[model samples]
Target chain A: MKYLNKSWIRKSSLFILSMILVSPLFAWAANAVDYSEPLENAAHQIGAIGEGYSLFSGIFPEYSLPGTNIVLDTAVAGFFGVLVTFGLAWSIGRIIKKGNE
Target chain B: MHIPDGYLDLWLCGIFYLLTLIVLSYSGYKARENLDEKKVPLIGVVAAAIFAAQMLNWPIPGGTSAHFVGGALAAILLGPYVGVLSMASVVTVQALMFGDGGILALGANIWNMALIDVFVGYLIFRLFKNKNKSIAAFLAGWIAITAASLFVGIQTGLSTIFKFQLQTTLLIMVIGHGVLGIIEGAITASAYRYLIDVRPDFFEKSNKKEVEA
Candidate 1:
């Protein structure tokens, strides 16, 4: 029992220490992936829209029905996103139930 | 929200991963305490179900797709500790089998989605427990998922900001997750409601313990 307990403690401590050492490297890699330049330009252009200035105007801003803004698009997107998630959850539930039976 | 490879600061991801591991370990202990040996199969089946469900992608409004992260639902059914463990299992399997999320990102993903959504969501549900089960479930599931998604979004935005443009990345993340949040909320609500009808036994067990207490 003593040996087992000591081994467990050593394993746990090692796991903790390794996590501490490895986490920073992951964060640095994440920081490197930020797409700032293009996003900044996009935000700037979007901010300029109310000033009667146009960028990417010829692309037909209304992809769907007329007068639908980004908010509406987001709402629409969210609605479907929820549906998909629910379907997945339910299907998983069904499978689990089946497997158990 | 499924965090990609480069979404969070490495340090933040590491911290989250450690935190998740701690929570998961604790939760696993608690689950072992509460459940009998016979329950293991049921839990395994449930975990598998959640794992498979999480992989199914549905299209969102902006031509993007999102999947289920079943933290809230698990908590609602199995209690918070068990819920978190179940979520951890699902996430671990996904990372290993499907490569849905990054290995390093697993910690953050589980913390943001599983720990937050399950525990926080269950707390909220308990708050509204006196009113109605279905309503409480809906509210809990909806709020929990939205909150988790937002947390993920903010983390993503911050990571992006650390490297690139702060404001733009924040804006994109917020907008993307805001939409994602609504979807998460709706799906959580629907699923919770469905389970309430089908598996009242699971929900009832918690209620019985409370009443017995």
Candidate 2:
């Protein structure tokens, strides 16, 4: 009973108040995303999974290769994007370690 | 979020590239000075994870969607320099392989996403972490992306080639990233909490931790 004091109560109240204030910031600014096409395409072919919502497309617009092989192109780019980045960083880290030694 | 090519003038491009080079070199130096074999693999895995995560998009409250930019998460987990290095790696790969960002603007993207996000996220989280880990993470993610967006807006405004308005660019960039930052923060806090619980060793043995201490 003695442990529950005024300062503790104030702190708890403030935390709750702050949380209430923050929730609306998220609520106010949301926009609608068109998921209809993605949903429709995903139903037709397994390749559709590699369509509009690709890992690389949003960041790199040039990645939007408009061809019959769009799926293959995007997939290859996405996988290689990870591989090349990993390889480059790993090599740099390795070099620095060796230099210090 | 990747600015395509032809947006920046040659001089602006050079300046951004130079800054990125300096930071990249410095980070590499710091990482090497206390080289650990495990950290190399760790860096690779984190970079790859970030690149993969960037692919997935989450819808915002509005009609738009935003994806994760793992800069802050990397900074909090690995410390700022390593975080920058990790992000730089991701940006570089996207430019060269996917043509995701413009080659000229690539440096600027790295500056914004990697440099600014990592440092801001690390600093903000460190500042408020004593209060609550989740809140700190949220602020880190939110502010880091907002700050990165500001930098991009400035770069676009600065370019003599582009007729972009600074205020409008800044507004759109900030608002968009501000929303996205929340997602980034939640992802960071959850992922980080999981990591700290399961793989605390990664932090304990990190070169940045050793140096900072």
Interface RMSD list for the candidates: 17.4, 12.0
The C-alpha stretches of model 1 lying farther than 4 A from their native spots are A1-101, B160-175, B207-213
Q: What lDDT score is found at residue A18 in candidate 2?
A: 41
On residues B99-212, what C-alpha lDDT tens digit does candidate 1 reach at each position?
A: 445566788878877788888888877888689766676677667876775666556555632353455555664565556656565666677787667556656765444333
lDDT of 2 by residue, B11-57 (tens): 99899999989988887777665556656666766787787666554
lDDT of 2 by residue, A1-101 (tens): 22224664455345433433332232232213432212122222323122222223344344334553434444444555566777887777777667877
**CAPRI-style quality class for the chain A–B interface of candidate 1:** incorrect
Q: Evaluate every candidate with DockQ and list the scores.
A: 0.03, 0.17
Docking class of 2: incorrect
User: Which structure among the candidates has the greatest TM-score?
Assistant: 2
Least accurate 10 contiguous residues by lDDT in model 1 chain B:
B55-64
Say what the RMSD of model 1 is: 16.3
